[model samples]
Target: MKVSPDGQPTADVIARVKDIPLYREAVARGHFPVLEKAEIARGFPDNWMTPALAAALDAGEAEFVLSTGTNHARMQLIRPPYFLLKSYYRLWSTHPDIKETWEAGCRRVSLTTVLATEHVARVNAKKRGEEPRPDPRPADRRLDARTFYLNTRLDPALWERADVERMLAEMAEARQAHPQGWYHLDCSGYHLAHLLQKINKWGLWDAFSPPASIIHAYEFTPVNVRRYLQQHFACPIIDLFGSTELGYLFYSDRRGRYHPYLEDMSVELAPVTEGSGLFHLIVTSVRNPHMPLVRYRSGDCARTLDGTPDPAKIKQFSGREKELLESPSGPVAQGDLDALVGSVSPHVFVHQLRVLSPAEAVLAYTTFDGRPLAPRQVAALGHGVRELTGRRCVLDHRDHIAIGKSGKYAWLARDGK
Candidate 1:
């Protein structure tokens, strides 16, 4: 394994860790020395536990357990030391630009439905008189709602019609009370658009104050969607990249380009198959001492604008690795689909493309809570998919699409085994 000048393992760290007999023995016995080290490093109570991670942490029988999987398969991963989370916070909070954003009291809303937000929502719901609602959705799990936003298990129906109107009214009232109040809107790209649509339906856009900025994390944001949101709002729309295990890794600047936030993490771009500009991302993060993920396969796809992984010169974050479609004409990446669909309906989430044949495909997706795509938008999505794949694709709306056991949205499912 190649260690950086600072003695931290590069992506090659995985191999080095594997080669360590003591470490291997500990892991083989389902003992997480890394977790213990992390706990000690973070100075937490010896028994301190993050409720969201309790299930995985207590599973002493598994060498590694997945913290999140979403659309991709769940990863039973080595846990990094708990101190790694602190390292991430220090890196992000101390960054001059990012710190300015955070210290300015800019709302730091997380737009993802992963464990972090789920935990918060669960913690928050306990403060209410009601029991946390039962979740039938694939992503629903009992969360500590006191610390999170809305619970992931809460039905989309709860945010519908009257409920949405009330929320918008409250937002408007907040704006009125504090003119300089900076609102931070965060979530999946699809959910933010849905919120905007609800505001629009109520003719509340003009009445509500535009947030100081908007951050879209967890999934790829299509180019057209980026343009549309930026054009409509007078604030900056930022896209961030990271995972549950890694936290935030990259953020877009004012120029609408991604810049690396992790000085300890290095990235490499490899071709999806062979001799293709389409590349897969491989990462080596050194901050997580408890569970260092070296050259961890993130299952995301991208193509460097300049064909290299120079953090300072990154030009774009294309899309997910598995979401690409290979057609006779060329490959259609998820960003392309995002662009087409966003043009049709910005509120669509959990998009999946299934190939029935070389010339036929099916598109399935769900709308963001409190919003629905118009019939015209659905037709446009079908037409766009057909045009991109050179195949007639059918667009279908489902009441819900199952989230993977890993709690991620799978955007593409190939037909047959």
Candidate 2:
């Protein structure tokens, strides 16, 4: 289905996006400028809030939530069954490696980064004139009493004693109805690592059943966290990539290599002018019947493995363009740091590398359970940074890596990004 030059979608495309008030003028002009966050956030509820969409929300056909990353509060969007479950029921539950969890009829548990709770708390606190306090412990595993996150995720700290007991009780009830001990652990890589750290500390490793698999999404997983999850969990650890505005786009195999999983969607990488070899993700998705965003700039960036702007060769989804750091070697993306950290050691749980000057840098890092890196490992980490950025560096062992005010991890932090 296509739109005519007269600024109208063919009978098919129009059947979905046309009646939407926000696209009325664009649809009439036979033109659709890319959907920017600012524009969508500015015209929200009024623009895309078509009668159909409104009806869907009221009738429980769709769920509403705000984007966590935006200049303003956030753009609200509606989804059918929320994005996560929508993707799972639509794609992941059927993948070869993932089919077992589905066939077992396992209970699905989601875990996102501890950052979400921390960041959402700060935002909510500011709104209520409450001062947010920093989590004294570096793990950032504490959950905010107030609810945060889209309807898609469970709280990061949901595995606490009371919660775990409750979960077991529910599983017991389910077993009584139908015998099944299998379950799926869905979470962010760091939170899974955090949960494992907590379990080890509490000596509760064997108290719980092994999951059929661990599905991690939401934020980019640190190399160390991914390694830890795989080593500790005797199950498939799958990595999913996508956003609330869009459904699942990509996922990773056990080797941590990403492969596209687009359905009713296509993607292309356009060279970003600020950083050579870096490209902004351009996606055309018609998957959602209500909001068929076409040629939308997703605001995320990545690099090609072979220096070609080919989606087939995408090395990494990297990070947001606004967060790109000006490195002595052009601009450093988060994926660049992730690669560097992986080279240093799999035990490096969390790291934040800041460029201090052309000749010097500092890396704040944490290891699994506060395990100190050997002098050789520290030397290797410093050497990797110097080789990549042409700068000598020093290591700073953080008691815990600090989460952004928004409860996100910035592997490459610069100028307070």
Candidate 3:
């Protein structure tokens, strides 16, 4: 069946869905329902396995992989090797703001979770029996000839002076390796912020090399973190929104305006709750030929500039659907609270909203400089929280916040959970 310019099939795409065992029964029932994770995991690869797919696997044309489990439990998936990296490179080479750097053959230095770095090392090793040798050298963590990994710890908040120094030295080496002495930085925005804080504390600016361009595609970066990066780096800071299952679908420009990159995909947004601005992202894509997703609920949420379903107007990829919270006014998303906090103070780095009771909550936060927020800023934050959640909020300051077991940070939690 031929697909339209917008990715909608002119004929029934269900024709293809019916071929897959997983959706055969649903198609036979004459009802094409939105696919969820539980249903996909019901029969494992047997449901999706075909003679041709098995042949592809045997020939090493496709492989099994697991999702990062950032927002939920890990999900098993099948795709061609380097599926995500190809998607990333396609965007980087064509994005108006970053194409010049990409075409220049710039080196990439990734600084994100240690889990991500370790995953790269494991994949590169190609052996699963024993753990890869612990090597602090960049060559051991190199993903490819053009890309290298930097961070080796689970949490950025716990990075010591030696950690900072080592990362800076490795980054300098990466920059020097480039013919132009410029390298591209790929990172989680939170990790970059932590690095910047440590660099400032130790006055290590000379040891670090500013990238020609930067992309933060790992997680939901708070608004303040983006602004903080702007103050330190003159390069373009782009935001990419996508997942492991689906390659990157959209990316932002230097001005923070998002543009769709759905070459073989389409997206629809459903309201998280009636009359609420937040929306759940439902995607249908043939990007991954091994496991084509049909109207898959991606478990991610977003918000539109005008609170409408226009994909072009998608202003923010807010947070995960599982992490959403309830309030008297409406549902509260991670981005909703992040915007409120950013407005109160740019000094706030990491934060978590702990719901104490139906009528009370606490906003715990840590500053960039290990100092508490001003009294006025704290009071403003409390007022803002109360207005947003219909609960009295107590502001608490701390020197550190913990990373999650998944190697990401949680923006909202309840009762120390």
In order, what lDDT does every prediction score? 0.56, 0.67, 0.87
- Candidate 3 error regions (>4 Å): 1-12, 127-130
Q: Judged by lDDT relative to the true structure, which candidate is superior, 1 or 3?
A: 3
- Candidate 2 lDDT over 1-417, as tens digits, reads 333443223556545677778777777887766667777666666777877788888898877666665322466776675455567555656766787767766555544644455555565566568676554221122223211232112343335665444433433433343255666666667666766676676666655556667788768876667777778776778887788788788877766677888786777677877448888887767787667776678888888788787776776788877767665668767878788888778888878877676677888888886877889988998888887777778899866766654545667655334
Best by lDDT: 3
Best-to-worst TM-score order: 3, 2, 1
Cα lDDT for residue 297, model 1?
63
User: What residue runs in model 2 are displaced by over 4 Å at the alpha carbon?
Assistant: 1-21, 24-32, 49-51, 54-63, 70-73, 81-83, 113-180, 355-360, 390-392, 415-417
| Model 1 Cα lDDT, one tens digit per residue, 133-240 | 444121233222111133243333225666555445544443444436765555566455555666676676665566665667766665544665766677666677
Candidate 3 residue pairs in clash (backbone atoms < 3 Å) = none
Better of 1 and 2 by TM-score: 2
C-alpha TM-scores of all predictions: 0.66, 0.77, 0.95
User: What does the lDDT come to for candidate 3?
Assistant: 0.87
Candidate 2: worst 10 consecutive residues by lDDT? Answer: 144-153
Clashing pairs in 2: 7-30, 111-186, 111-187, 111-188, 115-407
lDDT of 3 by residue, 321-354 (tens): 8888888888899999999999999999999999
* Most accurate candidate by TM-score: 3
